[model samples]
Every structure is written in structure tokens, then in C-alpha cells.
Target: MSSIKYLSAILILVGLSTCGAKNLQEQNTLQQTAVQLTDKTTPVVNKNTATPKEEEEEAIALPPKAPLPSKKDSTTAETFNHSRWDRILQKHVSNSGEVNYDALRNDPSELNIYIDALTHNTPTDAWTKEAILAYWINAYNALTIDLILKNYPVKSIKGIKNPWDQKLWQFGDTWQDLNTIEHKILRPMKEPRIHFAIVCASISCPKLQNKAFTASTLEIQLTQATKEFLNDPTKNELTKDAVQLSRIFKWFKKDFEITGSLIQFLNQYTDFEISESAKANYKDYNWNLNN
Candidate 1:
């Protein structure tokens, strides 16, 4: 009986020991798996946190862009106020042949007004067309003169470094050059006398009119300009020795060609008799700084 009892006790002890060993192995396996999962999840969380900082740093390294000037800000706002410009126009109407550029330029406020008007004020209809053209041309010339005066020692218009290029005389708004105001707007509108009407602030350029240009007297003003330029000895002289003339006749030969031969074109506005031989010696243009 004693031996059987002892054998049962030994069996129970061995069984208990085996069960404890199994439980310990299972516990170790579960712990290892948990450690691996924690290791993987920790890196994923760290990686997510790391990426945004790099992206933000890269964004911070870039420079800011410049703001573009609005059309109104660039043109009209820089030229003149509407009411003051009207008053100047009224004054011009009172005397169509005498403009006071000195008075206009002297008043810094009025100069600012002119600049604002030129920078803004786009014409939308025919009624405004003539006025706008004349206004812009006058504005461009005046502004150019102002620029030259401000930077008096500069050699040429090219030295000023403004945005004027040769093709600036196209009619579209995209080609809004100083030359465009002069040739495309002022000239092609069949205001042929505009050649002498808008001054370039140089001896070679047309004389600056003392009066402002108005829509009502635009035609007559243009006619007088054409006639006066052609009649002027410095511009178009018909002589046997040599045909001394303004370079404008040579530079814008194509413009005159539409009317006829240069001499024929001149004759339309003047009483001068230009011979064929005299017309043949058309001189080269001198585009010196027209200050």
C-alpha cells in the first residue's frame, strides 16, 4: 500500500513540473512577439513624425515671388486725375495754340495728376478715341522729357532703359509702347499732321505745341502740323545743291509712300516744288537722344 501511494505522488509531481515548464515557454513566446510588434510600430510612428519637418524645411528654403503691377496701377494711376485733366483741357480749348508746359511741369501735384492719368484711363469708344490718343502721345512725350530732365546727363533715349522697343507701334493693347501711341494711335487714325504735333524734346523732333490737343480740334491741329512741318526749311527744303531734310521723312518713308512719292506727299501739304533728283538723295536718320 505504501509503495503504491509513493508512486502516485511521484507521478503527480512530474505532471505539475511538466505543466509549469509548458506555461513558462508559452509566456516567453508571447513576450517575444509583443516586443517585435512594439519595435515595428515605434519606427512607423517616428517615420511619420520625421517626414513633415523635412517637407516644411524644403518649403521654407524657397524665395517669395514679386507682385505684378495692375494695368491701372501701371498706366492711369501714374498719370492724372479725371477732373483736373478736364480743367487743363478747358484751358487748352481757350487757346488752341499756346500750352504752358512750364506751368504744368512746375506744379508737382499736376505732374502727378498727369502721370496718374497716363497710367490709367483706357478709352473704350470713338468719342474717347481721339482724346485718348492725343492724351497718351502728349503724356508719353512729356513723361519722356521729364525722365530726361530728371536724369539730365544721360546720352540717349536708349540710355533711359524704359520698355520701348522698335515694334512698339502696333495697334493692340499688348504692344503698349511709346512709339505705339505716336505711330499706331496718333498717326494711323489719319491724323497725318501728328508727325509734327507730338514733340520728342529734341531739335530734330517736331516742335512741342503750346496748347493741349482736344477731340474737337484734332483734325485741324493735325492738318496744320503736316503743313507746318513740310513748309519748314529745316524739315523739307527743295534745292538743287542738296536736299537737306528732317530725318523723319527717311525713317517713316513707308508712311509717306502710301500717299505717293515723298515729294508728292510733301506737296499735298506745302507749296514747295521738289524735283525727282532732289527726292532721290533722301538722307539717313539720326536717332540721337531726343531730349
Candidate 2:
């Protein structure tokens, strides 16, 4: 009887162990199923990726840019107003680049207003190199107009008594002449394209553009005007192997040597390639006032 009772207790222990093992296995399977279901049902978010609408909103959310930096006057210069000159240029300079000098001379008030704006808005340390360039160009053209009106009915700009040398204009509180501005200021800027931008009130010179150069658009204006001047067949007379350039190139050859040769400079602005050893000469500069 004792042996039978001991066997019965052992059997009971074995059955309880089997039942616990089976329950653990079923619990593990249910846990795995729940995990898989959660993985499928829950949204998987990838922070790295964005929708297209988000990109458009980001692009459109930019703030308005200030024209001039809002800084103290002690640290900055006044912004130059080039609009007055633009208006005057549009009114007087024709679409074909012919200057109505008679009209320009008669309507001195607009020119005076532009000069006054220039005189007051002399750029300082706050100004950019572009601003300085635009200033001098407008100054040169305005003073040229003033000089022409002062002595109207003149055939050539050379007719004036040492026109370039005379300190005929007031630049801010200091006095400067056309020669000083061209040589001392703009030339040292090392941009030869100013040759095309600065008009000398002559037929041979670059045509007085109907628009004024502003600091905002100085770079594009300079580049475009240079290209136009070089590509103009009547002005440059370019060919496959020969180039008869304006007298301006001969006069300011050193300025165009940024690429080690004048041919390289001319090639930059011309569609037709000019040979490096192409026969180069200057045509006679017509000095008659650009009418």
C-alpha cells in the first residue's frame, strides 16, 4: 500500500508540471500575436521624410527683405535714391539711344533734383562696393549733362575747357572732377566693364542707356551692357579672325587685361570667338555729341 501511495504522489507532480509548461507555451504564442497586431495597426512615423505641401509652405514663409540695413547713422550711410535719375533718363533718352539734349538742357529742373539727391546721399562705410560704383557712374553722367547744358549747342565734349580736369561739381562736401572719379575711384575697382557703362556724351562712347544704374541691379546691368556693346556690329566690328574694337579698348587696354590678354576679354562678351592673335586696331572715335 505504501509503494502505491508514493507512485500516486509522483504521478500528480508530473501532471502539474506538464500543465504549467503547456500554459506557458500558449501565453507566449498569444503575446507574439498581440505584438504583431500592434505593429500592423499602429502608424509607423519616419521623421526624416516630409510631404510636398510642407516644402511649399517652408518656401513661402520667408520674410520681406529690407532694402537698406536698419542700422544707426553713425555706423551706416544714407541709401542713395537712384529713381530720380531713372525717371530723367526715361524721359529724355530715346529708345534708339538718341539723346534729346535740347529737351535735357531745357528741363534742367529734373537734372538738378537728381544732382541734389546724389550730393546728399554720398555713400559711406555702410555702402557696398556696388553702391560706390553706381554713385560715381550717375555722378559722371549727371555732371556731364550739367556741363553740356551749361554750354549748349556744342559739337563735341572736347570743346569744353579741360572738361575732365576742371573740378566743376560738388561730391558731398568734397569737390571732385570727372577725371578723378574715373581714374581714382572706378578704375581701381578693377572692372573694365565700366568702359561700357560710363557715357562721355559722344557718339563713339557707349550709348547713354535709357535706364539708370542702381545699386540693386548694378552687377547685371554692367554685365549686360558690356555684352551688348561688344556684340553690336557697328561698334565692335568682330569677325572670325579679326576684331576692330572701340577706341575705348585701346585707351583702357590695361583694364581689360584681367584674363592676361585683351582678346580673352573681348571673347568673354562676344558670341563669335576672336582669335588670340587676331589683328587688333581701334576705329576712329566719333566725338560729335551723341544727339
Lowest summed-lDDT stretch of 10 residues in model 1?
92-101
lDDT of 2 by residue, 1-291 (tens): 999999999999999999999999999999999999988894543446857776566657778676774554333455677888989899999865678889987778989988877777777767777888898898888888788888898989999889888887676787878898899989998988899988898988888888989888999999888988887766788887888889899899999997679998878777778888899877888888988
On TM-score, the candidate that comes out on top is 2
Per-model TM against the reference: 0.53, 0.73
lDDT of 1 by residue, 1-291 (tens): 999999999999999999999999999999999999887883433545668877677668789779977654453333222445455544532232333444444554755666555555555443345566567656665555555545555555556666344333223344365666666666676545566777665555665555556665667777777776666665566564346677777777777777567666766765556665663454444445542
Give the total clashing residue pairs for model 1. Answer: 22
Worst 10 residues of 2 by lDDT: 69-78
Where does candidate 1 stray beyond 4 Å? 1-107, 153-158, 162-176, 240-242, 282-291
